[model samples]
Target: MAYGYTGWGWPTGLRNGMGDAGLALGIIALVLFIAFPLAMILGVLALIFGGIGHARARRGEAGNRGQALAGMICGGVGLVLATLVLVLVVSTGDEEPNGRMDEGGYSATSVR
Candidate 1:
């Protein structure tokens, strides 16, 4: 009956909110893994929030530990996949269109 106070005394919804946000961000990250930068950012955020939520849950401060765990797992997987995709793109981008580089470090077609 007081400002910022719920029936359960102090509001514990903050932890659960973090868990929910983490889960949503993790799922979005997974869905957008091809956008490596965005996925990486989202994955990192998800991991952080999920970790916090999970820790709070473990301490009985919140109630959504399972959701937090799922978020952490998905975020980790997304982060790894995004890194792999980024590495693959960068590695492949260094090659010449014809699959060969000239002595001058330029593609043979670009030498002219």
Candidate 2:
């Protein structure tokens, strides 16, 4: 006997696609968290898509609630980490060197 088609396509629906995209972006953002600019961008997109997907799932418009939630959470954490790294770099960029080096490759300033 031949099985009948269930009529389900690859992505199924827009909301499902959003959930899938969100999950993928979230994972990428997390892995690239060291690159703050890229991570932030991907994280934001993941959050937006995941939020919409999750809302749709909750409303019975989609069926990937867990994936959406995971994406949102990972994106949020990655964004936070990226922001923290940015802050750390900015905060330390203006510090002056502790001491000047002499021709002999030793500190010119003497300890009191």
Candidate 3:
């Protein structure tokens, strides 16, 4: 009997592992982007992991290059959205003397 050449492949699972993780993190980040605080954290993580995954894919290690790239893009978009939300909240919150104004012309603190 002749043995087949099923020993090992050029690329290993390690590469795909990071790429898959990056893709998942990016998706989660995008989904939670509405939550500004969490978005920042998740976005950063996605970006980092996605960058690593992209590198691996570029080096012919991982097969999911598209996923890695998408993850990176999502992370960046999430970060931008989070920053915008934060800015809007801060700007609106500071518009009034107190925290915010109720339906009437009264300040939030005064109303309470």
Ranking by lDDT: 1, 2, 3
The total number of steric clashes, by the backbone 3 Å criterion, in model 2 comes to: 0
**Candidate 3 clashing pairs?**
none
Whole-model lDDT, candidate 2? 0.86
TM-score, per-candidate, Cα-based: 0.76, 0.72, 0.69
Better of 2 and 3 by TM-score: 2
Tell me the deviation in Å of residue 39 in model 1: 0.4
lDDT of 2 by residue, 1-112 (tens): 4988777568545457788889989999898998999999999999999998998899998888999999998898889889988998787665557643334544548634
Candidate 1 residues lying further than 4 Å off, grouped into runs, are 1-15, 102-112
Candidate 1 lDDT, tens digit per residue, 5-109?
445566635358788888999999998999999999999999999999999899888889999989999999999999999999988875677986435565669
How close to the true structure is residue 73 of candidate 2, measured as C-alpha lDDT? 88
Residue runs of model 2 more than 4 Å from their true location after superposition: 1-15, 96-112
Which residue window of length 10 is worst by lDDT in model 2? 99-108
Residue pairs with clashing backbones, model 1: none
Tell me, what's the RMSD of every candidate? 5.9, 6.2, 6.0
